[model samples]
Target: MSFVGKKYKLDKSENFDEYMKELGVGLVTRKMGNSLSPTVEVTLEGDTYTLTTTSTFKTSAISFKLGVEFDEETLDGRNVKSIITLDGNKLTQEQKGDKPTTIVREFTDNELITTLTIGNVKCVRVYKAV
Candidate 1:
């Protein structure tokens, strides 16, 4: 219930590399990195949650539960199947598909910090609740 109706942002500096790596990329992707700033809005209600990610590049939306599997895509257009579970105060999103990635989000310093990994590159993005 506490997690319901809460919002967060990505801490780009600390999470970018991790995110991309999880998406299945190597140094090549990092070398050709694009300047992207993604923001996420989360609304957890009852047994389901709605999450939205938006940036200059693309926007994605996801709705799922603790054990439910759902489909999602990255800003660069990578498809994935995702399932989110709670680990203490953090939420871990385990993604499956052609690109496997894991994203972790937690509340820190009054902001939401997210980390992503594709292959070798990692990235972090941060957002403040609005």
Candidate 2:
């Protein structure tokens, strides 16, 4: 279950606007974020895992190792410390900074679902393998 080389295309999104708003993303960025469907891919080099997100608007990437904390600049332009870990079929990440959030990516046979949560707001985005 290396997940390397697998590509998934965004198929559905729920409450994404609220999640972005919770992360302090401005209206224009949020709107741009909502308008496009991004393709996400996971790749590995040595012990480092890189998750890349690409859309017509912008492309973003984050590379990290399991259980190791790294400085991350989020798509919303926040500098946060993030660490990721794997549990069964899910890869979970906890980000700490001005607006803390948790992101979980669960893998299944046909789809990959990413859940982003902060406080009382939770957003789910589903990606189908492509």
TM-score of each: 0.70, 0.96
- The reply for model 2, stretches above 4 Å from the true place, is none
* Cα lDDT tens digits for candidate 1, 54-81: 7665677788888788877755567878
- For all candidates, the clash counts are 33, 0
Angstrom error of the Cα, residue 67, model 2: value is 0.2
- The worst-scoring run of ten residues by lDDT in candidate 2 lies at 1-10
Say what the RMSD of model 2 is. Answer: 0.9
Q: Name the runs in model 1 displaced over 4 angstroms.
A: 1-3, 9-12, 15-34
lDDT of each: 0.68, 0.92
Per-residue lDDT value at 32 in model 2 = 91
Q: Give the Å error, residue 92, model 1.
A: 0.5
Q: Clashes in candidate 2: how many? A: 0
